[model samples]
Target: MKSWLWLLVGLWPAFASGNDEAAELLKRVRAQHSADVVVSRYEIEIVRTEWQRTVIMAVTEDQRGGRYQGMVIAPRRLADTLYLKRDGRLWMVIPRLRRKVGISPAMLSEPWMGSDLSNQDILQGDAVIDDYQHRVIARDGDLVTIESTPLPGRPALWRRLRQQVRRDAVPVRVDYFDQDDVLQRRIEFSEVGEVGERRLPMVWRIVPMPEKGEYTLLKVSGVEFDPTLPDDAFNALEQATAGTATSP
Candidate 1:
């Protein structure tokens, strides 16, 4: 623990220069991802060398309060399984077992719903940028590569991230690395087009490193962003359905 703190302190001075430019670029990227309320259906395909599985989910996340809720919509066995994150706590409620359990620190780092993606990856999208200090590392034509390090004491799963973003500040890909700077995973964004007012990635594919034929693909089946959610939307389950908005 002490060593990690020392490492973060030692690394702080190097990222000071160009932090302004990095900050501005991240702001635009955040704007592209930001929404007051996000209601969407996601089709997640988990692929492995031995087998493959797919899960469909309905998600309603209140970005303003940092609360997220999701329920499985497919695969009879795991159907109706629910997940919730509120007030910095993660909970997984299994209707099959009639159990609700808080996620432990170890479990928090594990695969989310048996997918290659981590729990933090699904529950805290804000932490990708908000918990990291970023700096421009490289540039090529319309593509800019930026390296980001986790802020000290932050609950960031990855120690560092290298994100390739477009000139318009839309993120194209992100590589996640551990504390030792070993590449762990890569997330690529494509099928880019306008979603509401933002140029969003309709398909996201995450690949694990070290020649493992394991990955997860999340495609937005239907989505509407920043809709006027009902007041009881996040408070009550029965009437908590997302507000009206059409996806084109």
Candidate 2:
């Protein structure tokens, strides 16, 4: 009863192997997902060149492998963010001046607000089995277009990622390619179901090279998973009370 594989953290991870219907759609997304994830409050809206000029609001709480607290409201600098994950280490907290930033791995590729939210695309399912390597290449109706790449000296940033998963446990749609493969980015998944037990991805539209005007639209309006978040709200005095909370 315990078997949940597949784990690729975005952009590039040119994995192989196809046929067998991508191994039964990676065994139904590793038996309905579970790599740890917890969210109590959720609200993300970031649109840079699709409608609203610049609007970034985020209120999050995560506790999977441990820690991830956010507070980012933009209009002119307002960030009270903190992302922790003890033992394995990964910390970041910035309240204007209050510090605690140390998230390496080459910063995942940097660019969260300038778009394409990296940091391994918000820590994609945590334990990424050696960064990526999956197969399956086609299927339409219920999607399932996997393809990752990167494993030998990984310093990836789109070398392959044509994922469009959803074999019942939805929440996916990816397409980012570089290293001569072109296709910059196009990850669109709007309002997918289930949040409590998993099956995430409420909404995310990041089209950076599609029409060429630079794009970044993320929407996750309301999602509750693992509720009851209080552990000092995430220490550091809630990152200093998240710099005086704001944005509904």
Candidate 3:
């Protein structure tokens, strides 16, 4: 019994060290993707077996408060459509309806504009470190895999997440799992390049599980980090009124 107790005590520090390393690695990963503000354009392509649809949008994000505003600017029909997120709440402005509707937490997991990306995925921003409890699960070469569980009382759609990040702090792939621990989707990040003072992935491929040969590709363009954003950027009322006036 004495030897067993000693062995356990001797292994405790190694476990603690692994967790500490995981936290530090995650911190670095977050820093690489962090900015005061980010302005970018995204081309989202939804490829199906029978058809393909593409949408273009301008995105402005305030990293500090996790506020984001996106305006659809393509396809003529979706033009002037707006989405605003602030303080963990999302609102959508439809030009045809001339009203802004709030998005409930239950609907956050739904696809965004028929794309594989979810509404929650857009609003997550840089809050992963704060929303999940992480531990190092595996390490291979220069890549480290971390397993994360949603923190108690946090509003998260994925019950668990497994992310593989490079030693240079670039996220390569992330797998999302549901409450029943079933894998739902995976997002792969690539096209690493220098954006301002940091390196980031400029392309993201999202694939939903159990659906073969179907995926959504999101390509980032015109990325500007720490750009000045308008004060009313995330205001739902302002966006709704603008959509109403600019409806064409």
- Which candidate tops lDDT? 3
Residues 121-181, model 3: lDDT tens digits:
5555433445567788999999998887766897666788888888887778888799889
Local distance difference test, candidate 2: 0.53
Q: Would you list the rank order by lDDT, best first?
A: 3, 1, 2
Instruction: List the global CA lDDT of all models.
Output: 0.67, 0.53, 0.68
User: Model 1, 1-248: lDDT tens per residue?
Assistant: 10101111122222333587766776666666556677878888999988899999987877677667788898888988877666566677677665666676667678888887766655455434445787889989999887888777776667887878887866688787987889988878889878767776777888988748789898878777777777866652322223221111
- Residue 127, candidate 2: Cα error in Å is 21
Q: What is the lDDT of residue 247 in candidate 3?
A: 22
The alpha-carbon lDDT assigned to residue 108 of candidate 3 equals 74
> Which regions of candidate 3 fall more than 4 Å away from where they truly are?
1-18, 124-128, 152-156, 230-248
Writing each residue's lDDT as its tens digit, candidate 2 over 70-121 gives: 5555555654455444434445566675666666667656765455566555
Question: What total of clashing residue pairs does each candidate reach?
Answer: 0, 9, 0
Give candidate 2 regions above 4 Å deviation. Answer: 1-67, 70-99, 102-120, 123-160, 167-176, 182-226, 240-248
Per-prediction TM-score: 0.83, 0.29, 0.81
**Alpha-carbon error at 84 in model 2, in Å?**
5.3
